[model samples]
Target: MTREGRWSEPYEIFPQASGLFSHPVLVRISSQEIWLFYRKQQVGESISKPYVAFSFNSGVHWLEHRLLPPGIEGTTRNPPYVDRIRNRVYIPSFSVYESPDQELIGDSWVEIYNFFSRSWEGRMGPILGGSRNQVPIEPAIVKLTSNKLALFFRNASVEESYICLSVSTNQGISWSKLKNLPWRSYDNSISVQSGRNGKLYLFANSAPAGERLTCFSSYNEGITWNHPKLIDSGYSIDPSTYLDRQECMHHVYTSKDAQGTQRIKYYRIKEDTLLLNCPACWILEDVQESTEE
Candidate 1:
């Protein structure tokens, strides 16, 4: 998961969190608080549930409680995202449709949340400002120097699994028309960042589509990529970007064993580079303390 050996100290955060987390997201509000967003699973439903967790004093402890209400009519899947660019948090998930007995597909919704406003808005409006009939989960957003929020998403349509870009100049109130990005996003959903570097990086599967695999970054910010870099050993599915407590960045993915049990592994940022080729052993270290939503 991470590039550096925790001093080979075997540092990681797992064991307690397994098969219970989906759509994992974290935000460092300050040196003292870390915001966590995730969806808790319902027996038959896969969408409609989003939970919020917090860590105080730096991820040594954790407190998680339900954040989504009941009767939402979908399965809660996918993690939330925290944007350092605007200092707000957003979550995108698939809202399924179900018939009586929950057997059908419902309205698939993409919702975004603002930590400052404490408000939630649907992607159908100017929030995401995309023209796709359907938007795949895992939306990556970053604020450019122009102060415009550029949102990138995986196109569910067959044109290309490439990451599509859209710009919202007015703080997500209005967006530019859809623009096709030469950089595709299939294997991973996080390549968005807030940095001085002009180039952007995307994470996705380099292996053939539908096979589910690992992928790497771009030097030209979606303009051109170097080569397919492998991050996971057994094959990685969904990934998100995370910058941790020590100011170290990470590329995180959920790993599952043969028994179908899953664990979270993260790749640490070292010297501005993510070590994806090493054996995944980086652990999640969180400090837990309760904080109200």
Candidate 2:
């Protein structure tokens, strides 16, 4: 993390281990405290487990690498929505069940963790895959209203790949049937953020994969979305957004260098500027580099 919009030297947040670490999600609990949750798959293991590390000093230092309880996997790929008023963090996650003789099945759900108690309080669902044609995973959630929430998932289907949606009316306790949106996503992950001006924005890689990053805007709380606008190109994937205090939206994603090295890229655009621009207009440019690994 940098304060002056420049890349910092890459450093490991956790020591080397036997397994692989991937899908990191950072949640800021306070001005000085942040929690980093990620997936760890041990050697020779087919399933991944969730682990967390806490940074009490604004990500300068991280301590307490703890595995979450048996059932609760952390955010699959997107960041958790923090409800400060209720002192709960709603984590959009999923579970995968593998059968030796059968295919692997995946489903999406929401895990409610109470920050004050530091324990999981309630679980929303195991929103079934419904059919073998579509497998839902990597949910990105945003609040449409005080009582309504929208959950977007990557449809990991072999025959078709598109973004799907589910809605919750009572704080994620239950969800409506998962429906496919018109958007096509060859990339396996997506990020959604509710802008300051009540518009919803989604970021994902365009179809035919690794082509370009695209943004879709929803004006009616995600009932419908405008066509995607190009954000950047060149093998970018897994874009996530962070809205700062000044209403500037920070978009960070992974892009591959010429030699196939993965590099983190950063882009900043004012929320108001995005709101003012027409949906067909492109407003973002590559701003700076953050880290490379």
Candidate 3:
């Protein structure tokens, strides 16, 4: 979110994070050392475990591995994203399957991984008072200009769905109330980053006929957002965005059910043109033509 640059070819980045994997996820670069936030679900009932991959060669080759605790053993839910706040590195992810109906009801445990100790400690959920009505998932961590960390996620239900936000003062140790956002979507994942002028650029999934990941920009620190805009023509979702050295936004996503073939997409933004014919991206030429006009 500091500067913008193009993304290089993102090869099969997560060989370790496979099997029973439901929601595959990723995060941005490191302020000090560059790393990838991902998960592994190699077991049926086992939850997805949080993982880290260090990259020094511009992601051409990476040191991908699993990060574990001292005693307790279980997997993570989503990709664990890390951001620095006041010199402390905070790793955040949600845990599931440890209890009954933990995922659907989201009686989860939000945890933080400590780099200094190489250990992850956390607080149990039933978060937001376990309202018996609200179901929250898919957390996105944002570092504000003032160094406070705000975790935003989508609140979903067959009855109702909305976006929500929570704050932590001590670096993902604890969370505040889980409040709802003004809008909702079917399966929209958001990519949020700090803009140069203190605004926030949030890319989300809007309700089009195909329902793809759309765009929204905020000027007043996420208090409100601009109208949604389409980023590409395919059925793109699960946005993970980062800015590089030249101020251009780099986005990586999964192009699924497009022309009946699924593939990962790596793309970037330069003045206006959207490029997608990389080795990583899957082409939905027919869908693209259909969505036009």
Candidate 4:
């Protein structure tokens, strides 16, 4: 889409799936090249297989669809992460385990995609969870500092209901034990992004009014956060799509249309108001080293 609100014509790219194709995650690889990751599933089924397609002419034409690794379900709210320096894209996915008796056993897998090699990685290696029905599903990742990356997930366990956090130094290869975040979020999707001002902004629904969308800021690379500022209320928001700019933060959320259908909405919040009451906020001049990994 152009800045003037002009939208390009839509085209069919993944029309060969048996049931349905949904959850398109777009990442721009270059001025003319882009990548899209999506899911295909059978009718009335819950599981979905992940597939990816590349567009070389700015999405005007898409290449052949390639199915990602099996054993994991694709994501709807979790978008693939692009590391421009490394020329790799990281995808977050999860899968369930069932017993021989057809009973749900445990949520035993979490998958990550290495786009350079066109392969998948990551499993339920170290995160803590109980049963198949109660575990983290969506994983949102952000680079905190050099050699440091953070992963935020939406978990189903009551005790670990809040958005969970884990850190990795060697990228997503291995992670530290999971820890519960202080803020509460809808058990759907969470958003974490590095702001242009060198701070981290986390978007989630807070307690008492989980329906109200709120934003929090962390200056020391997610070590601590300032009080949340409410963005909007009364409507549910999937804080998945995010954009960071020098002046403001932009994100796309899903809301209900007048006809009761879900529609994508765009919103922007300026950075000045976000740090109104923040303590010891780091200024751009104070940032000497590149925090991006």
Candidate 5:
């Protein structure tokens, strides 16, 4: 937890041994109730399974660690969004399938979990057709209205790298075709969250293979994005929105150290700072000037 802009010491919530446990997605249902979903894969395995745990007191304690139902992989890279009004949790996830020729293919979908029944309510996608140049995976979702949602995907295409968008009007049952956004991201996870002030904030890697972290704000529910604000520069990956405070946005991502060790890092940026309408060229100029100072 963060207090007065200082993060507390990190503690372990889950223990894993003899396998790899990663891609954690934290969902806060209320001030007191929280849920964490992650992937667990054994050594030398090509496929991974999803597991979940609950934190009843704002993540102070985690309990009831269990595997999800058969065929249900939880959120892949981003947190699930909870619909308080309808009692539904929308999880954007993907599964990996190995071809006969030892090639791995990814299929993306949105799994709906019903809070009222405590069961999964089915899914809606394979949002992108298996195109050699597109290859969408790791979807991040943001609710636009009571019955509408927008999904942003990180493209895995090495030939053409760009983020894509898909919108759903009838909840998460159906979605529109995948379309390219103006921003560029390559094989990196992106995070999207709808702010309380009616704005959509997207965090992504601006460079082709993960060197810069940038935030883009959309005032019109993702139809258009304003100039991006540079958040950090380096090997930053898997940016996820952890919390939305009144004055700032809280994010957690992985950054590489000097020795190339991956470390979890926290970043907090004022919401108003990203809402500024400065041009990208001017912002780059200012950053260069500051570096020379």
Candidate 6:
């Protein structure tokens, strides 16, 4: 789609010859170059892995199909996020290990793709949910500072669910112990981006009642977060929003239409309105309610 809301005709970007190719993650490499990393899965199978391709002409013509390191089982809903500041691409994917009773255990992992060498590095976790029947997946990572990286994930199950946080000081090579956050996250989609105001903004689906996109800000770099402010509603889930250089936020999510069909939705918000709506850590607890509404 163009800036004027003109939709372009869909074409086959990359065709899989053997198995199913799906779950594409896109990143802008340069002015005219775009990079895509996707998963390839066999039909009727529960396992998948990552593959890479590039287009120098803005996704019109793609070339080079290569597999990324440490492709695991299961699936990836939100693709890898690119951190231009650190020049590394981070993917939060998971694999499942099963037992004889047909119980499935999920372990989340991270893969780093270096820009200069065009290669990938992989790391498995202990990310958030490690106990039995508690599955942690769909991780969203952000560079909290020049030396710190934060990994947030959904501690998911059929019962109660919420988001979990973990931090790494040495650029995601290893992670600290997982800490459960206060905010509820029923669905496993959380996006984190650094704002121009030097705060980290998180967009996710707040849970326990209604399904809505909620925004939260952290001034202390993931140590704590202010009370969340609901951004939008109407069965929104799996949010991926980013802050641009011009200070405008671009958000996209999975939504359902009137006929029960799933669709992609986009939203554009100013940085000022977001910062105002989602207060920082310095605000008093009593004053937080007055600022959000």
Pairs that collide in candidate 5 are: none
Q: Could you tally the backbone clashes for each prediction?
A: 36, 0, 7, 0, 0, 0
Residue 164, candidate 6: C-alpha displacement in angstroms:
0.6
Q: By TM-score, highest first, what's the ranking?
A: 2, 5, 4, 6, 3, 1
TM-score of each: 0.58, 0.82, 0.65, 0.77, 0.81, 0.76
Instruction: Score each candidate by Cα lDDT.
Output: 0.50, 0.75, 0.53, 0.64, 0.73, 0.67
lDDT of 5 by residue, 1-293 (tens): 36685658877675545677877877888789899998888789987778999888888888888898776667756677789888889888766566798555666778888876788787776575425566677778888734468788877666666787777776666676667777776667788878754577888888866879888876666665678878888988888774455667878788989999999888677767778864433111100001110
lDDT per residue as tens, model 1, 44-134: 6654366676777787777655465442222222233456566565443443344586433312223455666656544533333234333
Off by over 4 Å in 2: 1-10, 15-19, 41-48, 98-104, 128-132, 145-147, 272-293
Candidate 3 per-residue lDDT over residues 1-293, each given as its tens digit:
22464444545664654464344444434534455645556666555655556666655566746555532222222234454443334444443232364545553345555555555455433245225445666666677665556666666554556666665555454566666655574566666766555455666666643345765555555555555457766677667677666767777776766366866777778512222221212111110001111
True-vs-predicted CA distance for residue 26, candidate 5, Å: 1.1
Query: Which candidate tops lDDT?
Result: 2
| Residue-level lDDT tens digits of model 2 in 25-56 | 88888889899998889899997889999999
User: 2 or 3, which is superior by lDDT?
Assistant: 2
The TM-score between candidate 2 and the true structure equals 0.82
RMSD of 2: 7.8
Question: What TM-score does structure 6 among the candidates reach?
Answer: 0.76
| Superposition error at 170 for model 3 (Å) | 5.3
Better of 3 and 6 by lDDT: 6
Q: Best TM-score goes to which candidate? A: 2
